[model samples]
Target: MKSELDDQLCRKYPTLYRDRHGDPKSTAMCWGFDCGNGWFPVIDVLSELLSKHNAEVYASQVKKQFGSLHFYYSGRDKYTDGLVSSAQSLSSMLCEICGSQALIQTKYTGWFTTRCKEHTKDYSDKEYVELDVSKVAYLGFGKAWSALVLILIDSCDWRTEHNGMPATHLSITKEAGKLIVSHSGGDDFTYTIRSLHARFQ
Candidate 1:
């Protein structure tokens, strides 16, 4: 997926993706969603369903493997498991390039992909799938586009823990000409805006 959609999803559904930028050792999500743009709807629908579910479920990794959708996750009930299974099955009949109808058979060229007629010829044995950007909007990430950024800023952070914290009543006195930043929560690990970006990014 384009980095825009990827970032949008990670930021929109913070709880579902808190680990997306975390240490790879702690989460396969750090690799991010590894699939084509066509599967956006499938992922979108599934994410909506999973998010509404009462459990604190999360996906560890989402990718395409062997001409099929592979959504590996942890913390699921019987219904959520069924939802994942159904999404995987649905991918079998849809083009991985355009999300249109296609013959997703059990096999294809030695290196295979499930593609519609328009995209089948574009497949190659030497290359991994890299899809073009499509027009589909990942607006399903949230309902309100206007408030999404503000909502995300407060609700999501690269580190779910206190990114920059001190205490409720914090102190920030410039030692010399340099500036300082602190919160009431605790002393901030990063003292400058640029440093915070560097540390988080």
Candidate 2:
């Protein structure tokens, strides 16, 4: 998937494959895609905008947090913010997990994510699935995005949490010999939580 994505990015936006001094390279040097595959279209849009202007842009950060997608870049000037804002707006309507048309933001285990009605799960009204936190499992770890998220697979209907409030505080600790991860906008391990928090701060 990484190779395929790289190839596609290069072919679609060759300017991303350039060196710092504006020399085109065989591989993209400074670009990054830190979000899920669902936001590929948003990335494509941003890439196109950068390429169209020969802007020498470098994508340094991209992620989904607080139930929305975040696309940040280095080497940006006045023209880039507009493109980033547009992409982010589109991401709110699109599911972060599957790119479906999302009508609501869902929360699971104190973490928030945007999902379509079918994929959303309501843990309070329905039975809470016993999450096996004994073993270390990445709740929202991906090569692309570094967002604080709680993912529930094959669950009941989802209930909203935080009422669209942006996540502002996060913490994690040990409880009953299990990792108790929490995030803001809702509900983390200390080092892991701190590192993730640093990304936002």
Candidate 3:
């Protein structure tokens, strides 16, 4: 779901708004919901181009992938192509998270994100102990989550047994976006943990 500020931006660029099924207002869902408000300018330009050509434009998809916006449109013409090019150029200067003016693109912990100074600082500095699962931890947490946990462990250079045995003295920490496995050590790896279950499922 998009924030209220983003919903206002969506209303301003209705042409860029579409449900996951590519239907018009069929749902309150948004494909670019994860995208920051920076895309607003790009969509605004696209909307203007659509109006100029009197073309009916529909976004088949709109989302950020691989650190860039993947704005799939059904209509293609000189104007639309130009709009895409302009958007590409503009995206480099806009934060991928909040749409603020960005000064840098970072991959500090393996996940690439373009962000302004504020978001960049937040993302770069954000760190915490995500989990401390026991060997008997429930799998109801699901395979996807297990995969992520394993990845994070690998990133932090933490040793793990295939049996999912919880380390008696395992320590998980985050520093400079990379998960660190020890209370003190140089060993570390870069992996992003997208979601953490609040309770054992």
Quote model 3's TM-score: 0.47
Q: Over the stretch 1-201, how does candidate 3's per-residue lDDT look in tens digits?
A: 256755664566565454443445654234445566666555555555554554466666556655665667666764465455445444545576666555345466767655666666656544422223443144334333443344344423433343333343335444564433433332111211111111111
Candidates, ranked, TM-score: 1, 2, 3
Instruction: List, residue by residue over 123-180, the lDDT tens digit for candidate 1.
Output: 5434333322121122222212212222222222332355443323322333453323
Best by TM-score: 1
What local lDDT does model 1 show for residue 112? 49
Candidate 2 lDDT, 1-201, residue by residue in tens: 145665677677665544323323432243445455766665666677666755577654556767677765566654465455545655665666576656335354666565655556652233323323322245333312222122211000021232332333444444564444454542112222232222321
> TM-scores of all models?
0.57, 0.48, 0.47
Q: Give per-residue lDDT, candidate 1, residue 130.
A: 31
What are the runs in model 3 whose C-alpha is more than 4 Å off? Answer: 1-6, 9-32, 125-201
Report, for all candidates in order, the number of backbone clashes.
Answer: 9, 12, 2
